[model samples]
Target: MLLFRLMSALLGYVVILVTGKATERFVNMAASRGIYLWDITRVREGAVLLKVRLGAVKALRHIARRTKCRFHFERRVGFPFLYKRLLRRKALALGVLFFLGALYFLSSFVWFIEVKGTERLTVPEVLGAAAEAGLNRGMPKWRVEPGRVEAALEEKLPLVAWTGVYIKGAKVTIEVAERVVPDAEDNRPSHIIATKAGLVKDVLVLNGHPAVKEGDTVSPGQVLISGEIPPLEEPPKPGEEQKQGEEANKPKKPSRFVHARGIVRARVWYDGYGEAKIAETGRRLTGRSETRVSIKFKGKEIILSGDQNIPYELYETETFVKTIPQWRNLEVPVELVTIKYFEMAEYREELGIEGARSLAGERALAEAAGLVPEEAGIVNRSLEEVQTGHPENIVRVKVTVETIEEIGAESLFKP
Candidate 1:
């Protein structure tokens, strides 16, 4: 049925009203003569309305005259009439053609250039490299060769380890991966200082003289490794007599300086406190929700969905509003509002003294664990309960954590 309508629309068709003594005879004669007619409806004693293809209208005129019936066209439809209208307005056709041509012409050129995966390299630097390779914005896409762009980018920027160039529609994307370059070794005089006050657990010297040994208690900012080395004294010759005046006249050699590097592991202690009540009361959501939608126009609201009255006795409402965007000074006073209702219920939990104390201890330990470094080794943990003379309904727990961790950090200096 749809295909037949589409065909009728494409090849023109007409609706006609027939009036005479023998309107039925006219329709029958037209159908018998292979001129198809449909939607035949009688309006009065002699008038009838029907539809026939445009091409068969001329043949139907002869059949109508033979049947002594007169027919008049009511409406002309389909593509033929549309084409006639378009022919009368030639400017509209030209405008449509011009728009299509302009779109095609503009789409052939690159309009936007985007750079991705860039960290050490700046956007302008990448774009400059692409420009040198003839891949800049506004350049013709046909001339943009991905292989050439990638090779040129890698060659121009030595820091770039890999590059990918892609052109999608009117936009070009340049993705770059930078090479990881190691830092140069520092030979300046420096020292490894303690970052925190702790008891020295162990010390391993790699390139500097050790200042503090194992089992030593060091304060923060204390030097753990010394960068300065005193000059060694040489033994006098066995046959030569040592002169005190000559030794006094000679200037003492200066100490050597170097960039100190080493590890200083120490035992550190952290404390945390937590308290919990034996009886806790709060309101929690029941996970049952309803959404209501409405439209507001000129200070009037019309509900679109959901019930007007809330079903839950205790509930929370969350409202969201959406409105048309304002352009220039023109604003539309219409908005779509959505309200969500979340049902809530009262909840109470009663824990005994022992249970409260256990919960408080766990919470205190968790709090102290956050302060411990990831590489630290746990040595010991202790939990203590605080006591008050007055009676109380809450339990307070204190946690102490002992961890062995490296506390050495480099500090540069000039000697």
Candidate 2:
């Protein structure tokens, strides 16, 4: 049905009203003469309404005269009539053509340039390389060559390992991947010092003299490895008695300094305290909430939805307000306000003395565990309960954690 209507519209069609005693004879004559007519309906005693193709309307006049029937057009439709209307309004047609031409012309130039996947390289640096290759913003898309941009980036920036240039509509995207380079080694004279007070478990000197050994106790800021090496002194021969005067006249050699590097493992201890009450009381959410939205203008509010009053006896309220944006001192006084009410219930828990003690100990241990470094190896843990003179309804626990970890840190000083 849709296809038939589309064909009728494209070829143009007309609705006509036929009247006379021979209206039926006119329809039969038109159909027999290959002039198609459809939707034939009897309107009155001698009048009939129907539709015919635009090309067949001229032939219908001769058929109506031969059958002694007269007819007039009720409505004219389809593209042929629309084309005639356009011919009468030249300015509107010209405006449409100008809009399409402007759109086509503006889309050919790049408007936006975006750089992606650049961490070590700054955006300006990447854009500078691309600009040198004729891929800058506002350049025509046809003139931009992706191969040349990629090659230029790799050549100009030695840190960039890979690059990709793509043009999508009016936006050009340049993706860059930077190479990973190791930092240069420091050769300045330094010492490895203790960052915390602990007992040294092991010490291995890589480029300096050892200051602290195994089973040695060291305090914060104490040197674990010394960067200075003293010159060795040789004893005189057994029978050389006169060499004492020559030795007294000779000058002593100076000590050599170097950059100290080493690992110092030590045993560290951490303590945490926790307390819990036998009876606990708090408020918790019931997961039931109600929301109300309204508009506020000059301190007056108009409710948009939800109830006027809060329904829950005990609840918490959260409010959010949004107002129209202001432009250079022009501001709207109206604001959209949304309020949410969350239902809350009171809760109380009762734990016996033993249960409270266990909970307090667990809390203390968890607190102590958090203080331990990730690289530390746990060696031992212990918990102790504290008691006062009077027996109370609370339990207090203290936890101690021992860990073995590296404690060496570099400390530079003037020689």
Candidate 3:
């Protein structure tokens, strides 16, 4: 049925209103003459409406005259009529063509370029390399060959181990995998320097000359190991006085330089101070709370759920406001406000001197430990209570945390 309607509309169809005494006879005569008609509806006692293809309409006039009924076209629909109407409005047709042309032209060029999977490399660095491969923005997508672009990017960037190019519509995505090669052994002349000031506990030279030994104090930027290894000098034999002059004359062997590598363990101490009052008074949450939800519209608020009034006298409020997102200069004058009232209770405690000191010591130790690294080995921790000349209600404690860790770092030198 739908296909018949579509074919009828494609060939052009019209609805006709027939009015006369013999309207039923007119339809019967038309059906007998092999004229196709559909959607036949009776509008009134003497009036009838029906649809017929444009070709059958000319033949319907003869049948209408024989049956003594008059008919007139009520509506004309189909591709032919639509084409005639479009021909009348030339500007509309031209605008549609221009829109399609613009859309096709814009979609052919690459507009957005993105780089992914970059850890050590920067975005601009990857884009720069891609631009050198004829894969830059605004270039025609047809001109971009994925295979060539991938090869050029990999060749241009030494760190890129692999690369992939994908073109999806106007956006081109470039994904890269960086090389994960281990650092090679550095044979260049360099020195091991102290990264921080500490008391050197032990110094172990792996590939360079040691400058500091155990129980030595080192400062930041100070060289803990020398890269220049001096040549070993031998003492002269009993009768080798002339040989000493010859040895001095023989072009002295220059000192050998190497990339310094060593581990210098040092003792670093961190200090922190904390104080606790013997008598403390504060307010704390009791975990008993209630939530109230409400909606505010045009300066009027209405509670949606929960109690209208908070039950606690002393409480803390946690309010969260959710508003409808405004769009394009249109603002919604409504908001959902949720308020949580947590019951609070006043707390007062009087701790003796020993209790206060213990609490203050724990706080001070925690603060000092924050400065120590997780990889550092804990050597010692001590706390001391500070006392004033006159008695006071506060107990102040000073804590020290001592850790032993490697402090040696490579420092390049000009040999």
Candidate 4:
């Protein structure tokens, strides 16, 4: 039984591999011969299962003669009677059953959409978006294109700034980011204000009068622009037809509110601290990389790297697959794939202070350089301090940059 099982598995793989390879070679040969085979398939033990558009008979004869194999002609049909009969007889039957079972498992519609790490969004809203993206009830496994599906969902759901989708068997997984609505201004009329102290480098005014101009020095809460202005006309006196009299004739007060739109790049005095430490300290780092390929009926996850020779480490792997619907097309898999990684590696006191500090400084400097604005100037640098224990012992470096840029910004509008 075991031998038969082994043979069955081997035969299954052999058929798939041979069919794939033969189809590829046939394509290449046909292309070279100034012929085009639009469609092709391979059936090893039977008559020509595939009908090639380009040199059909000739290619068959060529292959048969080259491999010392017999060739026969047979009609292709919707129901592969001979193939089915052959497959049902032995271990091939088990493979056939397995393939059919996998197909069956993939047919059910995705019932639940479990979103992880969503704060402002509700579950129903996310699911509704998924439905809009065609990932809802009755969506075939093959038809659920995760990338396309996620994109579509994001378009309709404004709250989700970003999303990732995955499918495991019948369950569809969604990870969502909620739209962060900035705090609104008090209900009363207000003016746009500078959030920090800066010399006005530039100013744009929309919908409100400009209070500060280019080259103006301003403090926090000082209005950069004003929206609300005094009324142009006085109120009606003593209820003399207040609704329809002078009150109506009086031009409405110019609308008062914060200037709705603008970007101000200002040279602001700011302090930034970046620190690096020197020590031979080990730290745990997490790296995420995933690889995927179709295996058997379902897709399997494969890791290409990150396995290290250390004991104080942790590793985790996650896999997901969505199957396609049709089986006749051998080249296209019914299976879709995704892989996730969570790995942790730690280093101990394998080295002393100076070395660790140096490495930390290098890393921190790299980070600082990456973060620095192109036109910004470094105003100061603090000495690297070597301290025991985390972040400090790991490495510490502080850098300060002076730049003309606006950082603290808030919009008074609801959107």
**Which candidate leads the pack in TM-score?**
2
TM-score on alpha carbons, each prediction: 0.52, 0.54, 0.53, 0.32
Q: Please give the lDDT score at residue 198 for candidate 2.
A: 92
Which lDDT tens digits does candidate 3 get at residues 247-366?
768776678898888889999888988999999899999999999999999999999998987889999999999999999999999999999999999999999888899999999998
Off by over 4 Å in 2: 1-185, 236-250
Q: TM-score for model 1?
A: 0.52
Candidate 3 clash figure, as a count: 0
Expressed as tens digits, the lDDT of each residue in 121-166 for candidate 4 is 7788877777777777657667888998789867888777888998
Worst 10 residues of 1 by lDDT: 180-189
Return the candidate ranking by TM-score, descending.
2, 3, 1, 4
| Clashing residue pairs for model 1 | none
Runs in model 3 deviating more than 4 A are: 1-185, 242-252, 327-329
- The worst-scoring run of ten residues by lDDT in candidate 3 lies at 181-190
Candidate 1, position 169, lDDT: 91
Q: What is the lDDT of candidate 3?
A: 0.91
> Model 1: number of clashes?
0
Q: Write the per-residue lDDT of candidate 1 for residues 1-415, one digit (tens) a residue.
A: 8998899999999999999999888888888888888888998999999888899998987888798889898999999988897799889878878999999999999999999998889999999998998887788899999999999999999999999998889999899999987555477789999998899989998887889999999999999999987788888888988789999998999888888888899999989888888887778899999999999999999999999999899999999999999989999999999999999999878998998999999999999999999999999999999887777989999999999999999998878
Q: Candidate 3: TM-score? A: 0.53
What would the per-residue lDDT of candidate 2 be over residues 1-415, giving only the tens digit for each residue? 7998999999999999999999989999998998888999999999999999999998998998898899999999999987777789878778878999999999999999999998888999999989998887778899999999999999999999999998999999999999987544356778999999899999999988899899999999999999987788877678866667887889999988888999999999999888898887888899999999999999999999989999899999999999999989899899999999999999988988888999999999989999999999999999999988798878999999999999999998778
**What local lDDT does model 3 show for residue 255?**
89
